[model samples]
Target: MYFLTSTLNLSVIMFLASLSIPTSGLDCYSCSVCRQPFSKKTTDTMTGCTVCSISQTWVDGKRVTTTRGCDKSCSPADLRIKGNGLVKTCCKTDLCNGNTNLRWFKSVVLFSGLIVFKLTHI
Candidate 1:
């Protein structure tokens, strides 16, 4: 029982600790006219960014351009311009804004804890 309790405590501590770790900075891609989904062609790599962002401009309901870069502050929003549109996307992970599917980090940590717990019990 003591061993079980210790193991459970360790698992909880590990999960909590992972959640509290502070990132010194985030890395992101910086580019003008970045390709959709993701592109290998980035103009530069940005470090120490608070957020990563992608902006898309559409003309007559068709996407015409994409831009990717690091941002100090960003909020996802859409704006319309005379039947055209602009969309801005924001994410907290490295290079996350360039992709259509944002990667979730918390879920991975929880899954890892569950795996560790199962392996320890077995």
Candidate 2:
């Protein structure tokens, strides 16, 4: 009985995740074409996650830039770049390719804060 109740509680918590849309909604980590070691992140949008890996001829290492807001057409198989030193990847889960340090409770609180911010601004 206790196990069932605890499991149900966790299910409820997960079910109540904010900003989720019906029918394939997802929150992906979003950032633009930022340089390595100094990339920005956003988690308020619904879409697939992407990470573009670049390796410049003059640079000795590779750099990765991530983005969100991709549509249904975006898929892991579709992540590609024609350039010799660029490769992109796509994922279909919330912040799937991003850092996993933030806990679920913190994510919920932060997402709530974002909604409040948007409401106040409008």
Candidate 3:
């Protein structure tokens, strides 16, 4: 009985947590040739997107082209072949795919805050 009750409580908590996330689609930058590293002031924006993507191609260790737009799929990947390949990043939040390093930092901070909140509340 204790195990069943605990499981039920956990399920209810998970459902409530999911509801805290936004349901509306994200607003993301949409451009055919977005500048490398991205700049919000210089790019077009789109709304109602499931994901934001940045696709960059490189040749001989030099960046060749960069594109940013809204995507239906959400697959984040980085591939290299002899210093020449494509680096594609996809993010679900608004403008989250703009800067790679900055996005990572934001993720870390958000995760840490969530952990702290849970610990303190529990």
Candidate 4:
């Protein structure tokens, strides 16, 4: 009986410890391209999260594209560009300034807890 209790306690502790582990993922609060900002209104079904639009520009007469997001909020300066040209800008405002990281962190914690619970049961 003592051995069984010890094993159960250990399992419970391990499961709880796993709950304390930190997991991280990219979340987009706001995105901008060419000085245009997009809110986190758009969601990626696969990730079930909001993402920024891909910024595209013509460089040396060729189309160049880049992706932004994975953070809470982004600005035009964060995009970082050099040179001069008439660039197209696009943006969303629905989810601007949202706490994307916090949301992601909470989700990760919840998922970890679920996993730990399952493991403890096993």
lDDT of each: 0.69, 0.41, 0.71, 0.41
> Top TM-score: which candidate number?
3
Q: Residues 1-122, candidate 3: write the lDDT tens digits.
A: 98986677677567545533547988888888777666778888899887777787889987788888888785556686898998777666787666646357446446745755764575
Could you tell me how far off, in angstroms, the CA of residue 1 lies in candidate 3 after the best superposition?
22
Tens digits of per-residue lDDT, candidate 1, 1-122, equal 98997788788767656543428777788888766656556457788888788787889887788888888887666685875998777766666655644233334435655866875686
TM-score-superior candidate, 2 or 4: 2
As a whole number from 0 to 100, the lDDT of residue 83 in candidate 1 is: 52
lDDT of 2: 0.41
- Considering only N, C-alpha and C atoms within 3 Å, which residue pairs clash in candidate 2? none
- How well does each candidate superpose onto the true structure, as a TM-score? 0.58, 0.34, 0.64, 0.24
- Encode model 2's per-residue lDDT on 25-54: one tens digit a residue: 555544444334533353344453232121
Clashing pairs in 1: none
What does candidate 4's lDDT look like per residue over 1-122, in tens digits? 98997788788777666433324432334334322332345633122223332334545554454344443332332222454232322222233234323244345446655866776686
lDDT of 3 at 69: 84
Give me the displacement of residue 120 in model 2, in angstroms.
52
Candidate 1 regions off by >4 Å?
1-22, 41-43, 81-83, 101-122
Top of the candidates by lDDT: 3
